[model samples]
Target chain A: MSAELKKALYNISALADLGQAITSESVFHEKIQSVFYVITGTFLANRGAILSYDKSADRLITVTQKGFPPADLDRVDPEKLMSLGKNEPFLIGDSPVLAIAGVKILAPLWVRDEFIGVLLLSGKLTGSPYTQEDLELLNVIAHQIAIALNNHSLFMDLSDKLEENRRLYEEMRHIYHGTLQAFAAAIDAKDAYTQNHSYRVAKYSTAIARELGWNEHDIEGMYVAGYLHDVGKLAISNDLLNKVTPFTPEERAEIRKHSTTSHNITSKIKFPWQNVQDMVWHHHERLDGCGYPEALAQESLSDGVRILSLADSFDAMTSQRPYRKKMDVQTAITELKKCLESQFDNKIMLVFCKVLEKEIKGELPEPDILPYLDRDSDLSVISSMLEAIIQELSAP
Target chain B: MKTVQFSVTSRLVGDAAVIYPKGYLNNLSGESLVKECGIYIGKGITKIVVNFSETDLINSIGISLLLQIIEDLKNIKGTICCTNMSKFLQDTFEMLGLIQYMVVFPVESDALQYLKVGKV
Candidate 1:
């Protein structure tokens, strides 16, 4: 074979190898850097830089550079140099890009029909201008670089869309909580005395969690549990929830189902982090396992369930209801202590007591539990027993 | 958030159906409203007025439900408007672009009249 034919065949083989390498690469900077490496190595050029055109800003964006100062990249007019004929490699010192002293040639890069950018090449160590064969090889490689850049751009667009969708999904999950809150508000609308009761329960539970030094994530989880604890009441009627008269056996059974309903409702939310669904479901459970719905015992319950139980009891006791008036602070505290062994967790009640103490000492308008004592016919006995205990604890 | 007397009442004044939703308009209440409106629509009633005089609070979930009702009414080329909106809900309606599509009157009669004869 003729020497020219042999060199032509070798260039075609090298171009094919470099094309595979460029297309397989994903990172923009690294891919373009590889392009420059192949170009300079084949042509024996000491320095080279690739600049992709920014159609929006009408500027040449420097993608990669080797052995060249970046400062002069600003002075290189990529638009002016992009369409040069194959034989015309701009010489050194003619343009500001090659004017960087030792720099030599600038080859305009094209792909298909469009002008993509310019490839600036400096002098080889052998001290010779680019030969005809060298220029032909470099142009073919430039075509490969364009395909690589196009592939990289497409990959980036797809990646950005995926990220945007992920962000939207995260935002939608938060909005679901707001939707449930709205549902809670609608439920609250059924009665004036019970208004904001769930919100207050959540607030109280969060406070107790904070007092216990729980992490922010767990505190938020507790808040969700408290908020949804009474949500199952949505299935019952306003008449049933606010019935002044005592409920019949069937009505009472339906009313007692609210806790399980709340749990099921919260469970459907599917939160990304730790969920309070089970906690809300089990909020009505007692330590002695005499509570309603599933009647889960202490062993199956979590700290969140126990915390919600205390918070819900405190708010219900202190708040005014259709059948009962509000309870005084002292009386409510007594009731909470009395229920400790049967209804609530001691550890949770201890933290809640601190919250109550802060409000009492600060003279805050905490829920008035005094009227609740008047409504509960048997509360006076527990009240006196709690009062005696409080006096003993205060003696210290 | 609770309005004890919370209820959604419906009545017919000639060709226009008027719905008075009392209390907080959140998701649960919204579900009821959607069912009520769906009934009125199924009965071939189109022109409607939603009186919010008794409603004191509304949330995004409620707004989304309202959106559904509005979209359904619009599909039939039927007119629906609201009346007696609180100051906060008025702002909410404005921000959510609900005001541009539906006329909001400060009086129930005005909403009724607009729905009945297409006048503000």
Candidate 2:
């Protein structure tokens, strides 16, 4: 009803506008621009600037400004402003450090003990002196703006830390994969015939696990399990591992101890993915209770172990071994199909067949298994064989 | 209360520009009104008539935008005529002593007639 009441209501509405601008989902620059508009509009100041204190730079950088000489705003010392009271408006007298041409008021923005920024406003356009109420209103607006700026600063700090952490994690992961490759190479180096054997198994297991709808984390675990499954072979004597003759039961028993040794080696290290140890340990186990060491039967073995088991055997069959010549792609598929249900899970076999078929048909962008296979082999014959196997395995 | 988004439209009438501001005129969107006036001022038009018939509500932000237009016209030694103002708008301008900065009219035609006669 009265002019004072109307002006007060307008100030309250301006505060509401400030609140809306700060909380809006707009990006940082837009939100700061909106807030600048609210402040200038509320005070009817013809010239104004919102400056945020960059503590690192120890300078007052204008967030948004208008009608002021840009050079004058740039020269403002944040340290001098910090010496002023927090969130309190100080009339800009002809002080040496703050003697800007047209600025009539400065509110040093602070949250707690931290100096956040400053708000500058020229004389009102109406050519009237700012009342005590106007000063109080500016102080309130300054407080809100300080909080907003401080929140932005905090958010930026958190974002920077998160980005740094993400970069560090990526670096560590690169190094981690490198270390695993070196370990696999070391295991493969024990015997010339099994060169890159661990690498192929890792790829095959990863492809099968992916096709089986395992998440990326689990697929990574499967890959690691495949790579490290023969880590115990590092402990086995080189003569026993590369022996050209068929092993006696005594030597066969000695060779089987590598899986248990592999489990012992991996179990000491904590892996991000669950059951990596179990997957490496039980990779030699069979569903028909005929497997070595633990002899884990059906349901005792996890799908991860099943995948590693199948991948290991497939790579071993396709690769040249000292005891026997390598099987062709078709022969390997037949061997795998024949051994299914006895040693491997039907679901894992089906997924393996489907993935291999996809790789053979040139459907997968990066064929994990096909690259390591004998490239000179007839892919058409292998594709036909895989298609038949997929059909057979997919049948009820 | 539901707010209609603010918008500005303008047309050239003789030597003067007529700006129609619609909706609440209560936020940064109201800047378009100032921008519309600036366009005419840039073209060397000395007179602006803002018809506020559709703008039934305005806040301090709106007043600040009005002040910016008034200041712009003042700097150019030009005239700003506000017409078709609601009662609230008139009272607000009068209370803030802003009525003296510009002429007011009850209708758009009256402001156009005044500007036309003044052009003579």
TM-score (chain B only), all candidates: 0.91, 0.96
For candidate 1, give the lDDT of residue A263: 76
Model 1, A170-202: lDDT tens per residue? 798589669768877876787677888888788
lDDT of 2: 0.89
Instruction: Tell me the native contact fraction for each prediction.
Output: 0.00, 0.47
List the lowest-lDDT window of 10 residues for candidate 2 chain A.
A92-101
How many clashing pairs in candidate 2? 0
Winning candidate number (DockQ): 2
Candidate 2: where is the Cα deviation over 4 Å?
A: none
The superposed Cα distance between candidate 1 and the true structure at residue A205, in angstroms, equals: 2.7
Per-model TM-score on C-alpha atoms: 0.49, 0.96
Identify the candidate with maximal lDDT.
Answer: 2
| TM-score between candidate 2 and the true structure | 0.96
- RMSD over all Cα atoms, model 1: 30.8
